[model samples]
Target: MLCVEFFAILFLAYVILSLSFERFLVSRVKELYKSLIPTTSYINSINQAEDIDILTSNLQKLNSEKNLEIELLKKEQDYRREFIGNLAHELKTPLFTVQGYVLTLQDGVKDKKVVKKYLKQTSKGVDRLIYIIKDLDLITKFESGIASLDRKSFDIVEVVRNVFELLEMRASKDKIVLKFDKEYSKQLMVFADKDRIQQVLTNLIINSLKYGTERGVTEVSIEILKENKILIRIADNGEGIDEQHLPRLFERFYRVDKTRSRNQGGSGLGLAIVKHIIEAHDEKIFVESKVRIGSEFSFSLTLNQD
Candidate 1:
């Protein structure tokens, strides 16, 4: 009877312990699952699993996912901080410029020539502020999905020529020769937002002029990638960018040489705008650069079937 009773007691204890183990794991799982903040997209799957093996597996996966998410959030936070700081500095510089000129003029200068020059400078400062504000507005629209492309079949070659003609004087002033790789005997048609594509072309050619050396050549080329793909390339023989800066080249206000870029007189949001425009069109834009050789910017457009 004692042996039988001892066996029964052992069975009872095993059952109780098994029940207790499950409750313990379930409660602890709830605790850890609760600890995860919603900064990243961790799936909310709670497994009140009775099996120890399954429970442990679930916990491990959750922990690993949370750790990765936390790291991503930290990196994003750093970039956000940098972007905010750069934006503030960009706005402040033009504001101070306008203020200084305004105050100088307010002091009642007698020279007509000096007053005229100051007024011109003040106007230029105002123009810069306007450019920044307008570009910011455009980017915000693009980000929020308010901006859209009115894609249509158009002659890409003709557009390129028009842009070249429009910027011919500016290019000439900088001694930058704008030309095509080869003459197009017939119109090369592609489907895209004509106006936005023109804007992209304008911004890229202007960028080449801004960063390129005097007498540099800015060349445009078109290639047929496949039956459906048409590639448009704008290449420049300018001071090429370092590989390190290439990744963030399309980011707003990202300058390799901040002072020189500022002096170059652009909104500093040109590349950012160009990126958004291309991305919105569901196409990718790319850049290839060598430190001293030069840089080439390219994007593909859909070849119009009709």
Candidate 2:
């Protein structure tokens, strides 16, 4: 009996020792898991901080770009205002001269021929002043998006013919031959503001006439492409625009020959008006010229398919 009791006691002691060891091992595993959780949380927080920093950097870059754009816009606005002020000042001189001449004549400068000469010059100056003011007004309206187009469908040929007829007197006086090459069909129609389109054509034709060689020919041509657009080209045989000036030809108050242009009564705003008018119709205008050879001003307008 004592031997059996001793064996039972040994078995009980072994079980108790095993249970204590298992409890200690479980406690150690829990402590290890608890410690790892804080490390994982710390790593996640660091990654979040890095991401936030990167986002802040991107935002700052975007802000810098925006600020730069704002500054550019402001500068452009200032330049435009200054340009207009200068143009106004420039225009005022001739206007005041004409006014002074008229006043002098009114104050009894009696030679009829002398008076007539002054009157003619004054009249020319007045006309030039009127032209500049009109062009400036039109540009302002266009830039402000306040210019309304009178959209209509018209035969492109008819418009061309009309413009040709209107400028015939001037062309004849200049001894310049004006011709039209009818490459397109007679019934080609275009969708655009008729008056504005006519204005563009007039400006182009007059520009050609102004710069065309003495007694040289100026040609107007119409070409219809399969791309559903109509091209009108005004070409002149004259001293063509320089490569450097070509890009800025459509800018307001740009002059290739300032003195000659002024003497010829050019306000340097005609081409600019033409450009804006063409663009306002969602069309495009371009120019190509070779020095001493000639220049061709071409513009494309949407065609009426029907």
- Winning candidate number (TM-score): 1
> Candidate 1 on 255-274: residue-level lDDT in tens?
88887887887546999999
lDDT of 2 by residue, 1-306 (tens): 999999999999998887787656555544544454444432233322234454456447857998999999999999889787769865986888789888988898779999898999899778878877888999999999999999888988888889989999999998898888645455778889999999999999998889988898889988776689878899999879889998889988888998898777776889989999999999999999999999999999999876
Tell how far residue 154 is off in model 2, in angstroms.
1.1
lDDT, residue 303, candidate 1: 86
The window of 10 residues in a row where model 2 has the poorest summed lDDT is 41-50
TM-score of 1: 0.84
Report the Cα lDDT for residue 35, model 1. 63
- lDDT: which candidate is best? 1
